[model samples]
Target: MKYSELHGNIDRGFNVFLLILVSSIVFLLLNIFFYKFQDNISYFE
Candidate 1:
C-alpha cells in the first residue's frame, strides 16, 4: 500500500511538471513569433 501511494505521488508530480514545461515552451515560442512580426512591421515602415 505504501509503495503504491508513493508511486502515485511520483506520477502526479511528473505529470504536473510536464504540463508546466510544455506551457512555458509554448508561451516562449509565441512571444518570439510576436516579436519577430513586430520587427518586420517596423522594418517595412
Candidate 2:
C-alpha cells in the first residue's frame, strides 16, 4: 500500500512537470511568432 501511494505521488509530479514544459514551449513559440509578424508589418510600412 505504501509503495502504491508513493508511486501515485511520483506520477502526479511527473504530469505536472510535463504540463509546465509544454506550456513554456508553447509560450516561447508564440513570442517568436509575434515578433516575426511585427517585423513583417514594419517591413511593409
Best by TM-score: 2
lDDT by residue for model 2 (8-31), tens: 999999999999999999999999
In model 2, the runs with Cα more than 4 Å from the true position are none
Give, for candidate 1, the lowest lDDT window spanning 10 residues. 1-10
The TM-score between candidate 2 and the true structure equals 0.97
Return the lDDT, model 2, position 40: 100
Whole-model Cα lDDT of every candidate shown, in order: 1.00, 1.00
Q: Per-residue lDDT of 1-45 in model 1, one digit per residue for the tens?
A: 999999999999999999999999999999999999999999999
Per-model TM-score on C-alpha atoms? 0.91, 0.97
Candidate 1 wrong stretches, greater than 4 Å = none
| Alpha carbon lDDT at 36, candidate 2 | 100
